[model samples]
Target chain A: MLPTLPLGPFIFPTAGLVIIFGAWFCLWVIEKAALRLQLDAQATYTLAVVGLFAGFLGARLAFVALHWPAYQQNLIGILWPLTSGYAPLGGLATGIVAAFFYGRARQLPFAATLDALTPGLILGLMVISLADFLGGPGYGTLTAVPWGLSQYGVRRHPVQLYELLAGALTLLVWWRLVRGRRYDGQLFLTAVAVYSATRLFLDAFRDNTWIITNGYHGWQLVAFAALLLSLLLLARHDGNQ
Target chain B: MLRTRFEWVILIIVATLLGSAWIMMSQEPATAGSSLLTLAEAPIVGHPAPNFTLPGTVGQEVSLHDLAGQPVVLNFWATWCAPCRVEMPAFQQASVQYNGRAAIIGINQGEAAKNVTDFGAEYRITYPLLLDTDQQISRLYEVRGLPTTLFIDADGVVREVVIGAITPAVLQDRIERLLAEAGNP
Candidate 1:
């Protein structure tokens, strides 16, 4: 796997590079979408930056708190990044909270802001899937198909590529639906529904899922919940209209 | 105009899909036919353990070949590794519990003998601690990270490999599995 890329004397992790590029591209797309929607692009940019910083800090602090005994023994080890101690759930929750405050402080309409951000979010997901495919992290279950990739010396489904394809299709659907949309929050809800539905189906093929119990993935449950919430919101918006 | 924009979006999406599929198919398989096998290889799990001789803390050279017919727990650790220190007592306990039935060898990676000796004393480690000063043995076993433990059967086949700090219960379970694989009651 292309885990690391060598540039002269320096070594860079391909996954990290892909994620950085993804964030940059996502911000650029968000800025464009904000401009098109007549929202404050600068404020949107600030919100994204603040949310990312808060998320990173929250995840790191949560990780250190979990490994407090080890950090107590060697305080310097707390500074180490890329350790297998991150709490993604904590980061996600912190990011959403940060974004909400930033949005409120900027006096931006929540529905319009979410609609503007949907495309970039889908694109970012696609980039993450690409990174996963290259970095060999989120591998798939064993398969005998011709396109099955060799992971851990066995032919496995390229689930990351599957995710990428799903993300792309979701983005396209969002773009099509955004044109002449009747409701303010329709695009956002539709985007969420498409993305969550895609993830709910594709997560079944993932081998490294966080299983809750009885072979059910925690992420799959989350996806199903998100999908239902999106559908409910869509229906409510339509009824109001 | 909306229909035209929708058509463009569909066309671009199709093109992007075709391009990505082509790139994925054209590129070389990430792990295809590599000469070196990763540590997760199932075939290597049942294969003979790579033999190595290294200087031990007991003031003698210890070789894997010498421990024939005895299930061995080969632990790769370092003095500075927190997980290694955390699991040292469990390893020591396991060593004592299986005193005659199995042999536990701790391979210290590229560390000074004095440091390892001091750490061992602090942890009260009763197992043999071997020093891989040049990391020759670590490289051979593809030990990329600290605190990797390999459970080897009596016939010298590696039965299981644990990549992180293992609890005493897990260690005991793996040892029992290794012994079972070796046909020992």
Candidate 2:
């Protein structure tokens, strides 16, 4: 895995580069998807931008707060970018709240807005999986498959790639079948259901990650549960239509 | 367009079936490649830390297996690595704060014992600084970079790994978590 790259006069973290590209891609998709779904593209783009800034700010502030004792000695150290300490959960919560309020203030239709944001959100998650692949985290278990990538001196499943493929297929389904949906929530629910179902099946390849007691993969169970719920919601929405 | 409920269900089912077939058919468990696969080949969370013995500065011997029944903070560093140097003071402070409750061992990556001892003396570090002359320990632990610290619970299962220079707050936070886990041990 390529962790870092040296491009004359600057060293770039490969994962960081991937994330930047992914964010740009997500925003572009958000704008285009909004237009396609007859929502206000400019407002949706502004909301996304606001959420991005809020996420970064909230993450850094929460990290500094968690490590308050350390920053007490040198207050300026709170702005130290090299620390790279972030509270992702805090950032995510803040981002969602910011986006929700922005959308409400703009009077964007709730379900339609969700439909517009679905692809971009899924793309963001796909980027996370790609980053993990590049940064050498969340690797899969040992495998005897001929297509298995050799890692750590052994053949292993490319779980991250599998996730990427699953995400791409989900997007494809959204483009093909989710267009001209029966209801506003159909786009969102169908995307989540198809994606979560793939996760339920694919997460079996993962080893020693989020696998709670009884040797059950925790993420797979969560995905299965989410898929079932989404399907129920889909059926309900279908009946409403 | 998959408008009907049956269509969406069929679509997802076909996709999963295709994925399952691909994975199953591609795997050749009887191949030589499969033999290389073991239950726990890589250093991962929830797996026991690989045991190793390394020589410490000042004529002392240390082995990870001996540190059982207590939490462990394994810090891999080298004489170089600015980030490693940046976090040494924090590590030194932590070693003192958690003296008996937990153990923080510094494993110098492929450095001479003299260099390690000199660095320790420079920082006035009181804890043991083990020499990984050949970096065998680093490879065993799959340390990707310097200043990588692994917090292992009392049961010797790796709980978390911090890859950059750690601050006092993070160190203390992780140590507290480790200690909490070691309440019985």
Candidate 3:
């Protein structure tokens, strides 16, 4: 995998480049989906932008909190943003909270907002999968399949491709059937259910998936739970409709 | 009926995964080796730290194996990289804190020893700084960017590879993880 690209004597991290483009593309997707869902596209974009900023600050603060002792001596180091020190869980929690508040303040319907985000979410996942494929840590288990992409050494499963394919399929399904849906959040729930199923299948083939005790892939378990929850919500919504 | 149908779908997926777990699964500990060591002989996680002896900025030639039975941190840095400069103090501080328990070595990338010596003096960096004048060591380690740091456990297995500037907090956390993995802490 090419981690860095050398163009005109300056080397740029491939992941950084991909993410810059991916963020823009994902926002574009959210804006378009927002219009389709009859929500304010600009407002949705602003909510996402705020969520990202809050998530970044939350992640940095969480790291400082965890390693407070280390930062006591170098007080200015807390403001230094170059170093790698972040708590992802903190970022995720804060992002959700911030997004929720923004949506409410703007008088956006919760389920409708979620529906607007489904395609953008899928696009984000696809971008991450692509970045992982290029600058790794997302390679898959060994495989003898003809389409296997090489990573460590021997032929390995192209799990990123599998993920991208799944995202594309879900997005297609959403775009096609989202119109006049039975309920407001039906499309989001359906997409999540489908994504969770694919993830459960794909994580089994991934080499570096987070694993829990007793032969359980951590993501597989999470995906299973997500799949169940999404299906249940979708069923409830469909029945109510 | 609709709920029942969805429940059935859930049950089928659960059953399929449960059955497939027997054949091949990601949870098997044996399959979990250095995530980065999939490439043959690459100095990635789960692989032995590649062996190389480089001339220390001061005088002595330092070999990675010299730090055997102790955690080792190999910091690939350049004098010109600002992030590298920012983190050098933290590395110096950590080397003193975890001295003897861990070996923290700085490999200067393609810089003249005089410049490094001056920089070290300015920063008061006391760690053994080895010179990679030709960047052979960095190339071997596949370090594309400066300010890359590799944390190796006592067994000499590369545990973590961090690119970009490393804060004191992150540096401490990684070193602690290395010590814990090495069973010294």
Candidate 4:
């Protein structure tokens, strides 16, 4: 179902289109954030360009690492994102880290920039989840729940939609805070905490439950930790003001 | 302390992202496309089969596993897949020829039970029907196009996976090689 990347001998997925949409939307949000914060809009645009490239590279690299054995035999296939795989988390991670380092190299305030970019980041994640649902991968377990999707022939939990809805709600919260809240980075903290908490619960219905501690991953625990730490940072940032 | 805090935050984010990436990567099967021959690697012959399970008309559960310990022939058909209706007689013929040596499992991808059952009855298909209800099995095996056939070995390792429509001769030749490998005396 829209598996490969490209059109004919190649297959470019509608899913990739969604990913670009997410990135562009994030860039637009970043521009807005920069204007509101009185930061240079040029810096935001630079970050977006660099971050997008870095994110693509990072996502591909992460996919290759995870599926090294498969890619090893088919070296040429690695060039195509559809042939290999795509990891949103990996892309986001690499993008943010790259952007941070790039911003630092340019002598920009990394924390302040990150604060402005948070809502956009959340929105990007939500959009990607929606794409995943459309592509028929990254879905959760099967169930008899009324809302369960009848994919193929059996009823399955619409885990992708759950994540999407959760993401939308998180975005709404972030949007509200960014629009009206007095605190800088408050929306960022709320986005992190809300998304992390939703992800933790939604992961239950996911078919690929990476068993770590009590059926969770080390990453989720870290997300929980981030939620706590970010809240504290927001408090401190507010205190400074 | 300030620098340390920043480093910790970055490290945490990187680690989480890596972890999520790993999960997505693991979703693809490792044993895909390791077949020896080039012609065998064609999407029609070498691609992965749509994995599924269905309840036999007799009420006992039959699945891809039920055909294990013998070379298994998996055929995905539907009343709608034009080629599927045409391929039924060929499969029926092969089933009779390969009886007791290897089992033939017909998996219905995206077809309702009533439609599949009626189609099976119309074609006089004697083999067991497996339901890939949610297409979980289909997703697992990477079945893109319809009318797929997978040739699984006695050990449940796929010897060859076929996609698209198949003929009686093609099905029989493949079955003969598998039966020969099993040392059928």
Candidate 5:
């Protein structure tokens, strides 16, 4: 795994580079989608920027709070070192909340705004999956298949690639939904449903998923709930149409 | 304008495909080889141990290159690893058994110095325990698992790499071979 990329006297974490690039691409995609939909592109861009900052700050602050006692003892440790302690759930929660507030403050249509953002979100996920594959996180279960990638002295299924393929397919589905317009929020709901269903199916191959008792993964349950919610929204919107 | 939108969509899709292809091509060859072959090709064994100066638990900077004439057992471990806990006593025994001839250096991976010192004292470990705060040395060694032991001869060439919990007999056996190699060389 290429954990760090070295460029003549400086080394940067490859995953951080991928995430930053992905965020930039995500913002660009959202702007183009907003323009295509004849929506307020400037407001959407502002909201995306706000959401990204909130997510990053929220994740870092949550990590610091969790290790508050340690930081309290050594202020230098808290100030100087940037360790891998950010929580993904905290970041996701903060990003969603920040986007909601930004939309409300800008007087933007929530459904249409989300529809414009779907492609960027899927593409961002695709980039993150690629980063995970390269940086050796969320590794797959042991497999004897010819395509298995060697990790920790064992041939394992490349689940990160599976997630990337799933993200690509979801993006295609979103593209089709956008082309064949039905309702205001149809594209966004369908995108979420496709992505969630993909996660529900592909997460089984992941070795590091948190498994509850009875052989069920926590992420699989979350994906199922998200898929259900999206389908319900789609159904409600179809009835209105 | 509609045609331009379609073109943008096509461009995005094509870029995504190209990016995925590039990532796969770059990663597959490096990780596709057999695990044993990958371990062999790793820049660890048969190469000189990467030199680093780290703060030891005893308030001194310990550098691997400074201890030139003695066989060094560099074990990368963590205080919380169960296998590391199981193997500590064995390493402690081996340290005393080969007092002047070999050096047993325990490199704790990314833990506070206080915790490592407490654990070392609890285990009655007499060897020097160094703190790899940023885990730079661990990354340099490509140590994927805990309790990874590298036996370096007097010439600083890494001779053997042992993963997982090690017994006193096994540690002694490897140290004996390392000492033998050093003397003959």
Candidate 6:
């Protein structure tokens, strides 16, 4: 069983700390990248702040839309600060939108700024997966595999950790691409392709309560479409920048 | 970027009004307005039970309206709810003891059906169990707490609602009273 910290009667989640540190660390890394890229550090900081807030709202909105019945009676409780129900894909989508819009407002080149932010996004994902592993929510399928972990009560695959490892591997690929400057926008495309591919496999192990349509887990369908779209966009945009 | 002092004051006033309105609408109620309202002010009892049809255990079809002729006891439970496990044996005993006098329906909320089946094996609860995997019934009942039970009369009016572990005695007595009221022998 995972140990939870308590403040009086209420338990303060350790995963919450992990999330805070993850966001902070990502912003710090992005700030450094901004300095190196000769972009406005203040503007980068502002964009990060905006992304955090907007991403949180967007994630909650998506969760609510999917699970509206859960929130019908206690809409106030759903919006409470400590309540947890974030969609990582939703958050990433919103963060990317915020970053793009903020970049435009700040007169930053969208593609180059995306490249600069790639490493930070990878770090953010690593921390998210790690935090989810500690949290009880994102448990995986029961497996006879030797590496499977027992979470809450049952033995299951550590799919969150698998995701973390995949993220780290993607980060390494992004780092190499950024350092070598082999191809422009390669880091961003790789991030999308790699994460989507990883998600497609990882969701097979994830214990999802709701299957919306076509025997596909809700997120898996999103990941599949995303992978296709990312591949198509990369093919179209590559070498043209 | 420069604004006149009057314009700034008006802007500040408008912002304050909007902020206050937002806060008022977003906050949960602190007090009840009527006798039916409890401390939570939630509609747990005396409201019409929301009708739902879920796939019952053993491939049986279960519907809320199907149990309308008899007093129905709707229990919202899950494999993961600790209190639900604690209360299951009591419900099982009550259901068996009551026999045809009442219907005990356990609606499994937000869990895999296999997990629920395993849990049922452990608890040995012999009642009509419905699989509410998407939490449709849970939402209908406005269930904020686990192990919630609704006592519906023969006429399909919800008589009482219990939010926690209920003893077999209290449940049996409630069912008996409802049955007697309905002129059942």
First chain TM-score for all predictions: 0.92, 0.94, 0.95, 0.77, 0.93, 0.78
Better-scoring candidate (TM-score), 3 or 6? 3
Record all residue pairs in model 4 with backbone atoms less than 3 Å apart, i.e. clashing.
Answer: A4-A11, A5-A11, A5-A12, A6-A11, A6-A12, A153-B133, A154-B133, A154-B134, B53-B131, B54-B131
Descending-TM-score candidate ranking: 3, 2, 1, 5, 4, 6
DockQ of all predictions against the true structure, Cα-based: 0.08, 0.19, 0.42, 0.04, 0.04, 0.02
Largest DockQ belongs to which candidate?
3
Pairs that clash in candidate 5: none
Count residue pairs with overlapping backbones in model 3.
3
Q: Which lDDT tens digits does candidate 2 get at residues A1-241?
A: 6655568865556677888899999999999999998889999888888898789788878878887887899676666534457788889988889989998999988888888888998999899899878764477777889989886467779999999999999899888755568778678888998898888777877754664544456676677667767877776676566
**lDDT of all predictions:** 0.74, 0.79, 0.82, 0.66, 0.75, 0.68
> Model 6, A44-75: lDDT tens per residue?
76787788888888887776666565456556
**lDDT (tens digit, per residue) of candidate 6 on B1-185:** 11255554454455345434433332323331132222122223333466788997678889888877889998998877776776687689878977887899999988887888887777887898889989977876767567777888886767766656654445665787799979994
Candidate 5 residue lDDT tens string, B72-175 = 99999998898788678768877887889899999999999999999988889999999999999998888766777888888776765665565554566578
What DockQ was computed for model 4? 0.04
Sort the candidates on lDDT, descending order. 3, 2, 5, 1, 6, 4
Off by over 4 Å in 6: A1-3, A6-10, A36-38, A57-98, A151-154, A237-241, B1-185
- Considering the two chains of model 5, state its CAPRI-style docking category: incorrect
Comparing 1 and 4 by DockQ, which wins?
1
Off by over 4 Å in 1: A73-75, A81-84, B1-185
Positional deviation of A74 in candidate 3, in angstroms? 2.3
The residue pairs found clashing in candidate 3 are A152-B38, A152-B39, B34-B46
Worst 10 residues of 1 chain A by lDDT: A76-85
C-alpha DockQ for predicted model 3: 0.42
Interface RMSD of 6: 22.6
Q: Write the per-residue lDDT of candidate 4 for residues A55-82, one digit (tens) a residue.
A: 8889878866765654565565456424
TM-score of 2: 0.80
Worst 10-residue lDDT window for candidate 6 chain A reads: A207-216
| Span of ten consecutive residues with least summed lDDT in model 6 chain B | B32-41
